[model samples]
Target: MLGIFGSARKTAAAMADTAYWQLIIDGVTSRLGPAEALCLPARGPSRNMWNWHSKRLHPYLPSLQEEFRRLAAYQAREAGYADPGQTRSMTAPGRGQFVVGDGAVPASPVRGPGSKTKSKKKHAREKKEPGSAESDGGSAATGGESPKVAEDEPQANPRRKDPGAGWHVEGGEEEDGGHRVFGPKFVLTSVRDDRPLSRIVLDVRYQRPGKGYGGEAALAVSMLMDAAARLPGLTGACWDGALREIHRDQLMKAGLLIVSPQHDGIAPRRIALVTGCPCGNRHDLWSKGGALREAESLDTGEIHLTPTTGSRLEPCGGRRHRWYLLTRLSCGNTHRERLDTTREDHRRGLNRTEHLRQHPPDTDSYIHCYRWRPDAESLNAQLDATLWNRRMIAYGAPQQTLVMLALAQNALTRHLHHRQAPSTTRQERAPP
Candidate 1:
């Protein structure tokens, strides 16, 4: 809600009306959205629509975007708690329902932002020596005679202008399948559905790299924190490899299991080394190396060396050390010890998000929970389908957020209605 302050009084025309705001939102959602979605032809009256949008709608989008965020969050919250018996379409969530967090930087499909923001490719090209042939040819071409304008190679990114857009390149070298993606990214959080082709989007975030939002992983954790309580029986979070130790610890504290198939980095897969040691001095072995051996009345304690792959349950040769769970060690039959995070946090901080799960890639969980991560991509594809390149009818972070919220609201509304329609129909058809 926008607060109006100051003692100055104004006519109704100058005042903010919540009702007018709702009306404009509904109009834009129903007509303008369907029109622009998937590049569908926009069908509506011309004169009134333009006047209402330009005079009445455009100015208030910034505020309405926030309201729309509230609307979507509230609606998704209600949808999650809906009765399973009444809404047959709702996934019969179990004691430990899973949620997934994903993010994507949709190409802005515009040209200007990249020209101003992209410096990697430019810098890479600039690394050439100043006295090199390409530089000399450039100096010679600029002087005396008319400069020759060589036709440029086709641009990999599309062109249009949206303020605040940036260039983010993904993957490896260009020749080895690397490519440039230009735009602001959006992160989405959603509950996994057992019913095929069905998932409820809970929240969305519009972001740029290093903009205080803490990238995709941070945004995902923020969403899980908010959604954890509203969602009944939330026990595990399925995520990609981008999770960090701090973020993972946060979710682990909230009583959630993390399952990620990809490794976080080339770093070792151990979450944290088990505390206490056979040496009795209690020094922890962080890196892959030897266990220190100690003996009373000896000159210097001997060093018992071993590879990292040695059993965590027992030392290399000195004495046995009890590790909670060694690297890539399965929880085995009973996973209860891990359910209580207080018991595990101090001992592990390696690859688990335990929020940014740094599990070795292609692990078994990938077959079950992790596979559902693609549902997020499906949702993204649906949103992207509506984009022409990546430009939308709305622009800017706030405006982009509003578009995302609107689409999410529409999807939930339709799904909720479908979920409840059968029961409503049965009541009407009964002998009343």
Candidate 2:
């Protein structure tokens, strides 16, 4: 086990897997050395013990995840980072920053207990249509030590029935051509409020992505929603093109706006009537640099957004949810355009699962926080530094979450390193 994880000066605490990390006040250092914050101490409980507790601790997963979020929020608050009204750029909205999020599937693939020890697609069925295992339970926000699964559960034919571990087919489409993964998958969401290296975790389901059960778009919305409570005065978001008019409308309902890229899908951007004053110049909606500066109305000067579509019943939403977002002109003197937020025309079909996005392609808001959106690649790199093969060293999502929250404690220590990084520059500039 030591060789697999490489040797670390590990502490003799193997039974510390089931406690809320925010409550652990002992053996914690007040300051983290840079060397310590960047590396993972290779300490893992036995596989059987981890798997058993993963099952036992599944019910308490949500609160435990919440505890970890509070821990990160506490670190950010202590370092003076949870403010939405800070400034770092000449173009960023001086008002605040947005909660950025993204999802990833690593090289870590899982196999059924009955299958061979090989990791290939031949044994794993290629799911053309969507159908994945239902989430047994448990959610992990950030990347964690994806522990090994030996399926050591004591059951009759345990190989045939593993809880929560299942097959998930991602991109095989021509657009993304993503990957096919089977095992416990996670979205690994993040929230950074005006500070750098802030890995504030958002709750993401660790279920397989198929049957449209697991998509990062839903996770992105939930991540922003979660960050809203923790980081006050969050003004807007800049995500990949996964967001739509409905998502933008929802965020607007929450007093927020998203300047994310628009993807030309089965439906097009909102159509505008040419019966207006400045309706001559129409910008291509899907290009990277297609957006123009928002224009004010020739009449009122506040905002020129006017409703063009009608309200309708929201899909899958019971009597409660409705699609009130209609085609509205881009306000100000910039002219007229709509977001086609109401999927009024289901041309071909709603390609709701095509992933990849950025802030409205080439607009100013897109450039404002291009680096803010924490995508899968960055999180996967972090895991690569921590675990071998960039995979979780834990089994089920709950257990993987414990590993994640435990690692999230590193954020506190890492903040110390970030705090002292500029003191050297200060010394260099100080006149003796």
* Per-residue lDDT of candidate 2, residues 1-432 (tens digit): 222231121211323343422223222322444454335333435555544655677788898877766665554444455465664332365323455555544333245444444333322333323343312222244344333434333323433333445555454334566555545556665545444454555445454545474266666677676666676745556666666645655654454546555555533322323444365554322211333222235555653333222212112243222222222344323332332233643464432222212233554556666656544356546655665445555555566555555544244445443566576532212111
Error of 1 at 197 (Å): 4.6
Model 2 CA lDDT for position 97: 49
Per-candidate TM-score against the hidden true structure: 0.54, 0.56
lDDT of 1 by residue, 262-366 (tens): 332343222233334333342223322111111123346654322233122211111211112233212222111121234445565433333223222343333
For model 1, the stretches where C-alpha displacement exceeds 4 angstroms are 1-96, 112-160, 170-178, 211-213, 264-366, 412-421, 424-432
lDDT, candidate 2, equals 0.46
* Cα lDDT, model 1, residue 286: 31
RMSD of each: 13.2, 15.4
Q: Backbone clashes in each candidate structure, one number apiece?
A: 14, 23
Residue 179, model 1, lDDT: 78
